[model samples]
Target: MLVSHQQNSILKHESLLVKFLTKYLSRVDSDIYFAKSSRCVTHSFTKTATVLSMANDGTLDALPVVGLAHNDDKKIPRKRVYAWAFWDWATQPFNTVLITFVWVPSFLTSTFFLDPDVVGTAGEEVALGQLAANLGAGITIAGLLIAFLAPVLGQQADRTQRQKLQLMIFTGLLVLTQLGLSFVQPGQEWFWVGVGLIAIGSVFNEIAGVNYNALLVSVSNSKTVGKVSGLGWGFGYLGGIIALATVVGLILSGVLQGDSALTFQLVALGCTIWTVFFVIPIFVSVPEPKTRQVGEKLGLWGSYVELGRSVKRLYKEARPTFWFLLASAVYRDGLSAVFVFGAVIAGIVFGFGFTDLVIFGIALNVVAGISTIIAGRLDDRFGPKNVILVAVFGLVACTTAVFVLVDLGTPMFWAVGLILAAFVGPAQAASRSFLARVTPAGREGEVFGLYATTGRAAGWMASLLWAVFIQLAGNQAIYGLLGIALVLLVGGVMLLFVKAPARSPR
Candidate 1:
C-alpha cells in the first residue's frame, strides 16, 4: 500500500515491489532478512522506504530530498549533488599530501631528526627505523581509541541528525593539527611533536570520516550510491595527484627554497587550506537530515549498550553483513598498508630516488583514480560483492608479484607495483558499497561508524606482520610483502563465505 514517488513511472512500479519486499524485510523476528541493492534499505514500517532506488540501467530517478523544506524542491538538484561530491575532492590532500605520497615516510623518517645525543650511539639506521616504528605505534594507539569511540559518536549523530556538523568539527580540528606541523623542525627535540600532530590529525580525519560516510545515504540512494561513492573516492585520489603535482611544481619553480623540511611544512599548510575552502559547499548546500522518529536518544553509556544490542540484532537479522564487516576489516587494513608502506618499500628495497618515487606516486594516484571510478560502474552493474572479490584477488596476485620479483629492479616495481595500486581503491570503494547496501536506513551514521571501527580493529595485523616478516628475513625488507599479502589473502578468502545481497530491479 506504499505510494509511488511521482518522479519516475518505472520507479513507481519499483516502489510497489519494494513495498511488497518490505513486508518480508520487517520480519526481523525471522533468522535473517536479505534486501536487494544496498541503498534500498528501510527501517520498520514508519521510516522512509528508499524503494525507488537502484534500477537496471544504473542511474536512479531522483527521490524526495532528505531534508528539503520546500515542496517544489522535490528532485535532488544537480548543483547540490555536485557540491556534496566536492567534499571528497577537497579532502584528498590529507591522504595524498600528508599520509600517502609526501609527508610521513619521506620526511619524518629522514636523518634530519636523528638526535644529536643518539646519532652515534643508536646509529642512523636504528634511529630512522625507530622513527618509522614509533609512527606506526602512534597510529595503532589512535586506532584503539577510534575503535572505542567511533560507534558512540556515530550513534549520537544519528539521533540528533547532525552528521554534517560532526564532519565539520573534526575537519576543523584536522586542519588545526595540520597547521601545527609547521612547528616541527629538525632534531630529536621536535620529532615526537611531528609524530603527535600526524597522529592527532589522523584521529580528526577518521572521526570526521564517520559523519562524511553517513552523508552518503542522505545525498544518494541505491542506484547512484556506487558511482557516487566511486566519484568521491576517485576525486580523493585525483586530489592527492593534484597535491603532489603542486609539490612538484613548487620544487620545480624553486618556491620550496631547497629545504626538504620546509617543503613538507609548506605542503601540509597547503593541504590544510585546501580542506578548509573545499568543505564549505556541503554545509552551504546539503541540509542536515530530519531527526529519526526511532524513540528517544540514548545517553553515551546507554548508546554502548544499544550498540551491543544493535550488533546482536544485526547478527540475527543481517548475518551476511555482520560477518562481512569482520572479513572486510582485515583486508581493508592490508589495502591501507599497501600505500602506508609502499614508499618505504620502494625506497628501502627497490632503491627509488626521491624524484623517481614522487613521479611514480603521481602515476600510481592517477591509476588508482581511474580504476576506482571504473570499478564504481562495475559495482553498480555486477554488485559490490563481485567487484570486491575481483579487486581483492587482483591485489593478492599483484602484491605477490611485487614480492616474487624483488630481484628484478625498478622496472618490476613499475609494472606490478602500479597493478597493486590499481586494486586498492576499488576494494576500498566496493567495501563501502557493500556495507551501505545492507545497513538499515535510519542507522546509516552509526553503522558506518561501526564500519570505521571494525576496519580499525584489525589495524594492527598487517603492520605487525610486516615487522615480523622483516625480522624473520634478517631485516631484508622485501620479505615484508608476504606479510601484507597474507592479510589480504586471508581477508579475501573470508569474503567468499559472505553471500551477496539480493539485487532489486526497476
Candidate 2:
C-alpha cells in the first residue's frame, strides 16, 4: 500500500512538470512567430537567438525583466533604427570637433584669446590657467541648467508625444550655436562670446540627447537593444574619425588659408552643414509614439511633483534601474571629462602640437569605434553590467596610470590614452543598453529623462573636481587626471552594489 501511494505521488509531480514545460514551450513558439513576423517588417535576423530558463532564486522579481514592457509593443522598423542612429553621426562633429579636440582647445584656450601683454610672458601660463578655470565654471553652469530642465522637458515630451519635434527644435538651436562659433574671431574681446556659445551648445546638445536616448526603445527591442546602442555610439565615433581626418587633410592640403583662426571657423561651418544634412533622416523616419503617456495633465511646477513621485515609485518597483541611474550619473561625468579635457592634457602637459592632437583624435576615435561595436556583442553575451564594470575598471586604471606616468612623455600618453579611449565607448554604449533593457514600457522618455537629470545632477563633479585639484596643485593641470580617476573609482564601486537587470531570453 505504501509503494502504491508513492508511485501515484510521483506520477502527479511528473504530470505537473509536463504541464509547465508545455506552457513555457508554447510561449517560446509564440515569441519565435512574433520574431519572424517582425523580420518581415524590419530586416533579416543577423544573429541566432539563445533561450535561458528563468532563474530559480526569483531575481527576476527583484529586477525588471527585459521584455516585460516590450512584449506587447509592435516591432520597430529597421529604417527607423538606422535613421535614429544617424542622429549620433550627425551630432558627432559637435562633440568630437567643436567640443573636444579641435575648436575649444585649439582656439578658445589659445594665446589669441589672452591679453596681448600676457602672451609669451611669464604670466602666460597663469592667464591660460585662468581661462581653463573659466571653462570649467561655464560647463558647471551648463550642467546645472541641464539638471533643472532635462527631466521636466522630457516629461512634457512623453506626455505630448513630441519627442521628435523637440529633438528637431533643440538640434536646430545646437546648429545655430555651432554656426555662431564661426563668428568668434581671435581677440580677448571675443573670448567670452566663444565661452558662452560653447556653454549654450552643451546645454542644447544634452537636452536633445534626452529625447534621442528615449527613442532607443522606438528603434529597438530587448533582444537588439545592446547591439543597437553600441551601433549608435560606434557610428558617432566613426563619424568623428572621418570628420577629424577631413580637418587634418584640409590643414595639410592648405585649403583653409587665412587667419589661423579661420580654419576653426570653417570647421564650425562644416559641422553645422553636416548636422543639417544628417538630422533630416530622424525627423523623417522615426514616427511619434502612437499614443501619449498622459498620466496626468500636470503644470510645469506640477511636473516636478510628478517627477518626484515617479522617482519614489522607481525606487520601490524598479530598484535595479534606479540604482544603475545613480551610479552611472557619477561615472558618466568622469567619462565626459575624459574627452572634454583630453586635448588640453595632450597639448599642455604632454606638449602635443596641432598635427599630433588631430592624429591622436583620429586614432582615439578609431579605437573607440571598433571596440564599441565589438563590445556590443559582449554586452549581449556576458550582460551589460559586466561589460560596464570591465570598462569602468579599465578607465580608472588607465587614468591613474596617466597621472602617475606623467614624466614618461608623449609616447606613454599615446599608448595609455588610446587604451583609455577604448574603454569609453563600451561604457557609454553599455549604459545606454542597460537603461533600455530595464525601462518600464511606455515611459521611455520619462525614464531616460531622469537618466539625463541624474547624470547632470552629478555632472558638475568632474569639472569641479578637476578645476579644484588643478588649483590646489598650484595650477598644475596634470593633477586634474587624478580628479577624474577618483570620480570613476567611486562610480565603479557604487555600480558593484547595484543589481543587474534581468537578462533577455534571446
Candidate 3:
C-alpha cells in the first residue's frame, strides 16, 4: 500500500510539471495564455513548480504581488488589455496637443501674448525668451507639488484599493484644466493665467499617471508586463500622431482659420473632447485591481511617516529598486524637457512655422510608436535595464548632435530630431517595465507613487538648467538642448552602476 501511494504521488507531480512547461513554452510575442486551473508555477531559484491553490471549476484566482488573475475562459481576453492601453491613447493629447506641439509654442509665447511695450523695446526675441523662461518656472512649481502629494496619495490608494477612483478624479481635473485653456485669450494679462492653468493641469496629469502606471499589474503577468507597457506607450504615440495630424488637417483645410487665439482655443477644446471620449473605455472595461494585504490605511500625517519608512525599507531590502528610482528620476526629467521644449526649439531656433511644427510632431510620433513597440520585445529578451541603457545612449548622442549642428539648419534638425524621437518612447516604456518587475505584491500603487514622487522631486533639475543655460547663452533656445543632454548623460552613468533586477523564469 505504501509503495502504491508513492507511485501515484510521483505521477501527479510529473503531470503538473509537464502542464506548466507546455503553457510556458507556448508563449509568443504579444501574450501568453495559461491554464484556467487555479494553479500557477511561480518563479523560484529551485526550478520547481509549486501550486498555490485548487478549485473544482479550475478558474484561477489572482496571485499575490504580480496580480496574475485568470478569467473563467482559458485564454486572456484581448479586449480588457486593449481597453487598459486606451487610457494612454486618451491622455496623450495633453502632452502632444496642448503642452508640446501646439498651445504653448504657437500661441502662449506668440506676439499676441507679449507686452506690446516689451516687444517694441526689447525685440520679439527677448520677449519670447522671457515668456519661455516663465513657462519653465511654472512647470517647476507644478513638479514640486507632485513631489509633495504623490507618495501620500499613492500609499492611501494602495491600502484602500482606490486607484481607479483616484485616477478618474484626477483625470476629470485634467480635462477641466484643458477646457479652461480655451478661455486663455492671447494677451499679457492672460499669459500668466495660461501658465497657471497648464501648471495645474500638469500636476493632475502626473498624479493620474501614478495610478495608471500602478494599474499595469492588474492586466499583465511577469511574462507579458514588458510587452503590455510597450503597447500602452505605443498607443500614446499613435494617439499623438492622429491628434497632431487632425490639427494640421484642420489648419490646412481652413476649418480652423481665424485669429491665432481662436485657432488655438479651438484646438484646446478639441483636445478636451478627445480626452473625454477615449478615456471612458479604461474605466469601463478594465476591472479594478483586487485588494491585498498592503497593511492598514493611515491618515495624512501617518501616510507621510509610512512613506518615509517605506523608503528606508526599500533602501535596505530592495536596493536595486531604490537605485533605479533615483537614476530614472534624473533621466526622466531630461526626457520630459525634450517634449516640453521641442516645439519651442523648432519654432524659435529652426524657424519652423506653425504648420511645420505640427508636421514635425506627426512624423515624430510615427517613429516613436513603432520603435517603442519593437523595443518592448527586446526588453523581454534582453532585460529592461539593457534596453533603457541603449535607448539613453542613443538619446544622448542624438540630442548632442541637435545642439552642436544647429547651424546646419532645418534639414539637420529633422534628421536628428526623428532619430531622437525614436529613443524617447522606448526608454519610457522600458523604465515602467523595470519598476513593475521589482514592485512587491499589492504595493503597486505605493511603489509607482514613489516612482512619481522621486521623478518629480528631481524634475526641477532639467527645467532649471534649461532656463539657466538659455539665459547664460544669451537666451538662445538652441543651447537648452545641451542642458538636456547633460542630464541624460549623468543619469545613464548612474544607471550603469545600479544592478538589473533578476529575470523571471521562461
Candidate 4:
C-alpha cells in the first residue's frame, strides 16, 4: 500500500511539471523559452509514501514582441526623417506661390486698383490699406474660431486612436481649399473667394499641423527631435523657393502673362499638387500611434470638456510653457508681419518689379534655409535660447534699419531686407526647438496648439498697427515696421528672464 501511494505521488508531481511547461510555453512561445529545468524527489518518498519535490526553472526573455519592443531608444531612419520633413516642403508652395508671390501683389496692383480720385486724395498713401483690412478681418475671424476649437481638437486627437485619420482629413481640407483658389479670377468677387479660401485653408492647416506635430515623438528619439524639426522648416523654405521659381519663370517667359488670371490659377494648382505629393512620406513612414483608450470615444461637446480639463491641468502643471507661449506669440507675430509687409514695402519704397521680387524671394529662401540648418546644429550644441536671442536682436537691428535708413534708391533697403530674411529662418527654427526642449512627452500637440493660437491671436495686431502707423505717420510705413522691431526686442528681453527647463540640453 505504501509503494502504491509513492507511485501515485510521483505521477502527480510529473503532471504538475507538464502543466507548468505548457503554460509557460504558450505565453512566451519563440520570443522566450525555458533555458534549463531541474526536478528532485526526496528519498523519504519511498520509505513512508511522503514525497517532497522541488523544481528550478530558468527562462530566456530577450525576444521581440509582435508590435512592441523593450528598447527605449528606437528611432526611424534619417531617410524617413527627410521624407517627413518634406511635408513642410510640400505645403509651403501655397504660401509662396499663391499668397505672397502671385495673388496678393497682383490683386493690389490690378483688380483692386483705387480710383484716380481716391489715389490723388491719398497721394501715394495707398499703403495697401483695403487689402490689409480684408486680410486682417479674415485672420481675426479665423483666429477667434481657432482659439475656441484648436484645444478641443488637440484633446480629442490625444484621447483617440484616429490621429492619423484626423490628419488625413484636415490635410485633404487644406489641399481642397488651395485647389479651390484656382477658380478665383481677377475681380471683386474673386477677392472675397480668395480671402475665404485662405481663411479656411489656414484653419485646416493649423488643425492638421497639430496632429502632424504629435506624430514626431513616435518617429524620433528625444536627442534628435530638434534636428528633425529644423530640417522640416528648412525643407519648407526650399519648397517655397522651387514654387516661386516655377511661377516666376512662367510669368517672365510670357508663358503665363502677368495680366492673365491664368497665371494665378496655375500657381494655385501648383500649390495643391505640392501639398498632395509632399505629404506622401508622412503617410508611408510614420505609423499611427496606438492609444490606450481605444473604442472609448468623445463627442464634439466632449472634446470641449476635455479641452477645459486640459487647460486646467496646464494651468496647474505648465505655467512656464504658458509664459513662453505668451512671449513667443507676440514675437512670432512680429516676425510674420515683417515678412508680410516686406514685399509691399519693397514694391512701394524701392520700386521692385516682378523679376526683382522673385529674385529677392529666392534669395530669402536660400538664406533662410541655410540659416535654419546652421541654427539647428547650434541649437544642439549651444542651446536654442541663445540662438533665438541673437536672431531676435539681428531682426531688431535690420528692421530698424529698414525703418530709419531705407528710402527710394537707397542701398540700405535691399541690404537690410536680405539681412532680415537671413535672421527669419534661424529665429523661427530656434523658437520651435526651444519649445520642443521645454515640452514634455505626449504634450507636444497641446503646446503647439497654444503656439498656433498665440501666433494667430494677435497676428492682426502688427498689420493693424502698421496700417495705423502708415495712415497717421504718412509715408512712414518704415516707422510702423520699426515699431514691430521694438515689440520683438521687448519680447526677447522678457525671454531672457525665464529659466530654461531642467530637461533642456543646455
lDDT minimum window of 10 residues, candidate 4: 62-71
Please say which candidate is ahead in lDDT: 1 or 4: 1
Models 1 onward score TM values of 0.84, 0.84, 0.83, 0.78
Please provide, for model 4 over 186-284, each residue's C-alpha lDDT reduced to its tens digit, 9 standing for 90 to 100.
655566677888888878877887777766655444344455566677778876876677667767877777777776677677678667766887788
Tens-place lDDT per residue, model 2, 1-506, is: 01123345433543563354335324433342233222211110111011112346663433443322343245555557668877998898998888777788778988879999888999999999898779868887887888888888888887887888889999999999988998888988898899999999999999999889988766666556776688789878877777677676767777764248878888888888778877888899987755436665568899899899889877865677789999999999899889877777998998888788789889999999878977877886778999999999899999899999888998899999889988999999999989877766556677888888898888778888999999999999999988999999999999999877655565
Q: After superposition, how far is residue 430 of candidate 2 from its true place, in Å?
A: 0.6
Better of 2 and 4 by lDDT: 2
Question: For residues 181-234, could you state the per-residue lDDT of candidate 3 as single tens digits?
Answer: 988987799999999999999999999999999888777766666777887898
What local lDDT does model 4 show for residue 5? Answer: 30
Clashing pairs in 2: none
- Considering lDDT, which of the candidate structures 1 and 2 is the better prediction for this target? 2
Q: What's the true lDDT of residue 236 in model 3?
A: 88
Clashing pairs in 1: 36-502, 38-437
- On residues 1-506, what C-alpha lDDT tens digit does candidate 1 reach at each position? 00123125323433553354335224421211111232323453223223433335534321212221111123444445556666877777776777766677667767768877666673777888888889878877778888888998888888877788998899889889988885678877888888888888888888988888877765555555566577678767776776677677677777674357777777777777777767888889877654354546788899999999888877765667689889999899899888877777999988888788889999998899878877876786778889898888898898888888888988988999788778988888888777766676567678888899999888889989999999999998888889999999999999998877544342
- The predictions' CA RMSDs to the true structure, in order, are 11.2, 15.1, 12.7, 19.4
